[model samples]
Target: MHREIGPLRALANGVFCLGLLGLAGFGAVQVAGKNWQVQDTYHLSAAFDSISGLEPGGRVFVQGVDAGVVEAIVPPSTPGDPVRLTLRIDARLRPLIRTDAEARIVTQGVVGARVVEIRPGSAEAEILPDGGVIASEKPLELADLMQKASAALERLDTVAGSAEEGLAEVNAIASAIRGGEGTLGRLLTDDEPVNRLVQLTDRGEQTLADIQDNLDALKNTWPISRYFTRRGYDDRDLALYRPNASRKSMTISESDLFDPGRAVLTKAGREQLNSVAEWTKEHLTKKTEVVIASFTDNSLDDLMAERLTQQQAEAIREYLVDNHGIDSAGWFRSRTVAAVGFGRHRPRMISAEPQGTSPDRRVEIILFTPQAAS
Candidate 1:
């Protein structure tokens, strides 16, 4: 074989050797790129609830740019404490890292290696110290997601079973009705039950009308007429009464009067109302009318907020009229008290506070006096 020693064979052999060298150089460059060591780097740390897949030597990115490497991972000394990670970042990027910067563990791509992503804080934020701990967002774990999905599926199964049972019961009831086996079934099958129900409804309505008529006659009677007039029990509607001017106003926080998410007043609420009662007694005049309005900021829907505020206003009015014996009738022989709920609408600014940050959950009591005689 050595006797030939042709030029073509020698040329082919040289080409193969050069190709091998080129491949080796390419591999070395790749390995070095993966494990590049930063020079004059500074250390920062972060604590996470869970760092399921990240490990030391993992890349750290700042705002999606390759910035550094994770130096080490330290397990908590106590069982329930978070896992801490130390990061070694290039000194060049130190100014960009801020005190409010956040670190989160994220996968590079689907099924790819995990890396730490740092979201740089705003420019106005103070620079983070070299060794300061950056705030960490808990990593989303595939296992936890699977567990939640399984739980949701189980709940769906339970709901399906309940629906099946309910449908079966409904079918049975329908069958019974068709066969005229029970009271409801008989009512459906016969006409007498329907007629009886109609008669009963008519009788109830007639009874209510008679009661109202007798009450009206009693109000006009001589002995009780004076008391009824003083109480403002007349044909005039309170809805028509309107105030010409507001003389004074007092505002109280909703928390001071009612418990959270309820219209019912507490003992402290009663005490607070007692103070309002005293204030009213001192300032109330024959020509003045009282109006209580409530507002709320927490409700997502306007209608619900309105209902809640209305109930709260009613509760306050009830306390003032029944408990404190505050007169609700004016000298003009008309109702002088009104309660309204504005909900989140027409919000009052408290102490020059901005609307966005103002305390919207509050009750306002205003005294309306007739326009001064010109």
Candidate 2:
């Protein structure tokens, strides 16, 4: 009976140890995250001058959509160096991010934690590649505001002191006049001084009129005219910056923008793009968008045809981005530039000739001008 009891006691200890191991494993899993599955995402990085309150695990928003999270905050090497932030963004929403997209540190509330907000660059801009390093802008913090306010107060104090001195000087002059101490006192008693003061007032008014004339001349010039006369027309200029104000569409043969069926840009293509970029940059506002669509011959396999067209469109977009930068308002009169490949699906301009000709292989650039097309 003693030997049987000894064997049963050993088995009971083994069972108790297994129960403790199971509890430890469960605790580890719970600490990891609520769901054990890993999310499908891509990585992006940005450098900021200072991210004072940004923390790891902060939320990232894209145009108000919760699109990603901050993964880590890397310390700068030197005191004045920029801090690098790692971001884990959704893979599917990659296209929304363009080169012009900007990252900023934003606050939850008056005293809440800080989060990063990503404003999408443009609807027509090229998608940022995975693991790309983008630009970042630092938001104004409470500390910075306080420092500015303090400086302003110091200036106010200086101005107040100067004003007090000015008042004292004016009082001294009045007292001198009352006592008839100087030339000003003599002028107060003479008609010649009054005539001189009238002459000085007339000169000041003429000087102001000349300055106004100079500003009007500047407004009529090429560079200054754009800003001063943003209103180009009469009250009917309601369509100046509207989305559908003046829509213009044109189709360029693949030969004009690219080699036959190939995506490599030729000399003429570059020239065409330079002109287009300049025109688009000048006319496009923040809200405007530009779309570049590519086409291919229908004779090829459907998949290959679609893929080729897309590559062509992407090639054009790449050129535009590299030369023009991301099309957005923040980046110097930029507009959102996007690209799509139709693959012979929508051939608005049918080739009058044979099916083998490469006219079907073309690119269509649709421009949405903010102002009326002249």
Candidate 3:
């Protein structure tokens, strides 16, 4: 081994050794470069319920293009808090990343390393600032899916068993009926049961008719008759007709249109009525009816209060019909004008003031329009 060698042979061996060292150095540089922070990059973060296999140094993609890398993963201080991921992204993508952009953990190809995938938000959204957190979609876990599938199968099995039991019970009942072994079976087999059922139905119809007749007669009787008249139930046409549910209304305070304790409209009240007439002319249709409801805040007895409010409501109706030429006849020749009085018994309004405050005496003019026929 110590024997002298040729110079040419020695020089060739030295060259081969140098080549091997260079190759090793090149590989070392390549390995370190994977974790190196590239220049001209910006930082961003996202929160996820679970990162699962995603880790630091993972690549980040935007719409299938390589755009950045995951710089760090911060575990939550609390057990239930989300896992946070810091990302180092190319500065060129800064304008494309929006506040609404969503991030998710995904794998590249089958059996490849996990990476972060960002879905760029709509152009109308504001751009996300550096170091800002982006929205994250929870990563789907294979284990969780499997557990849910197993639970679904268990429920299906239970349902199938119950269905089988129900089928057996149904078959047993069918067999009993076929054998004429129960009351239902007997009723199906005999004609007397059918005849008896028909007779019972006839009797029930007669009883209902008698009850209806009694109610009609009661509606026409003494004290009750007055109540029905006030409610507009005395008119058979109005009682049977169903109006459309939608309506428009205008309210004016009693003091605005009338003097205290008087149902007569003041001069200002006439002006207010003229304005209401203009509004009604714009919105009124042939199928629409007018309703005038008046309320009073006076301390008069119920009878006197009723009379006063009635007079007030009638006055407004008369002025609209006589002065503005509003029609009194509505759809199908029915009386479209309805005037009602609630003396000291004000119905609730949509724009009512707070409770514990006494409301002003007011008048409400409402237009009830029928729905268009199909």
Candidate 4:
């Protein structure tokens, strides 16, 4: 205005401020498309038992998508129940339906447009509320799945006519095992035990090729060639009764029954007398020890400086042979000494000095034995 300011009037005031910044960016996308089409609403009801093709503007689904609409069907003020509908939906899916939400009335394809879905239930429940109702869903349509597939094809045609009469009694037992009659029709008409098993497999392959040509002529003959030389002086003495319990298949009585001072035993002295008769039949029950006298200490440092015990020295050798009478009953002798040991541990002292220990040492009996338990 301070005069000319020309340049085509400053390019028409910069095209009117670029058309007011494209009309304020087309009025801010038309006020953000009416504030993103303002959704947030709720309502939901349902009931139904037969809302015959649900109406009031229909479309309210949830899992099948749509999400809102059917605002009112009516007739459910409770008389004989069922018919409610209501819906309105979309409050951002009122926290996904719940309080046992169910709804139904579905349809849409066999002629489309029936709607009302809803579904979504257990989010640990409690969301429902704004008009609540729900609970309807019986579904299973396609004319009730073709009347349950025509009663499961009439129980699979009565189990395929009892498996075609059990396959016509297994085709009359395979035509009685192919006409012969049974036992596979006498083994398919036996040929005298199939020609006696083909003449016993050809006389057992000619008696196994004549016993391999008589063991290849007894491997070139003689004891079959001195069977280990002159049958070792012919069972010397019948191999001392048991050289392979020989009845004379000898070798000088199996070499004087393995002599090493041969009175005959030597199979390593009959396996060391059968391991000493299996350790004398595992120690055939012998137990008697009972002597135990101690404290007169023949030094193991005076039997551990006197801790003598073998049942307190056999209760002081039966109190010195029955109450101090000491006749050394059969030379009584007991001694178990080990003053200190260490490796297999030691310190087990028990004394008896003729059962002494009372004098004022505070009650000390000490006789313990009962541990023989192997």
Which prediction has more favorable lDDT, 2 or 4?
2
lDDT of 1 at 35: 61
Where does the lowest 10-residue lDDT sum fall in candidate 4?
A: 245-254
In Å, residue 113's CA in model 3 sits off its true spot by: 6.0
Tens digits of lDDT, candidate 1, 1-374: 55876999999999999999999998988876556552578899999978888999999999667888998999999989999999988788898899989999988855789999998887889999989999999896756655655655565555556555555655665686678776866668888656755655565565556555555555554434655443332432332234455467778889999997689999999999999999987877777777777888866488888888878987998889888766545421434566677777764433222345447898877776678757
Query: Local error of candidate 3 at 212, Å?
Result: 49
Q: If scored against the real structure, what TM-score would every candidate get? A: 0.40, 0.39, 0.39, 0.21
Assess candidate 1 and give its lDDT: 0.75
User: Could you tell me how far off, in angstroms, the CA of residue 36 lies in candidate 4 after the best superposition?
Assistant: 36
What TM-score does structure 1 among the candidates reach?
Answer: 0.40
**Local accuracy by lDDT, each model:** 0.75, 0.70, 0.74, 0.48
Question: By descending lDDT, how would the candidates be arranged?
Answer: 1, 3, 2, 4
Residue ranges of candidate 2 with Cα displaced over 4 Å: 1-40, 77-81, 138-141, 172-374
Q: Which stretches of candidate 4 lie over 4 Å from their true place?
A: 1-84, 87-100, 105-123, 129-138, 169-171, 174-185, 188-374
Model 2 lDDT-worst window of ten = 231-240
TM-score of 4: 0.21
lDDT of 2 by residue, 1-374 (tens): 45455878889999999999999987877654322124568889999998888888888888767777888899999899999999988777788899889999988755788888887788787888888887888776877665655655565555556555555655665686788776865777888657755755565565456555555544554434543333222122121133434565556788888777677889999999888777666656666666676777778788888778877877888887778874556733555565677786753432221244446877766666556555
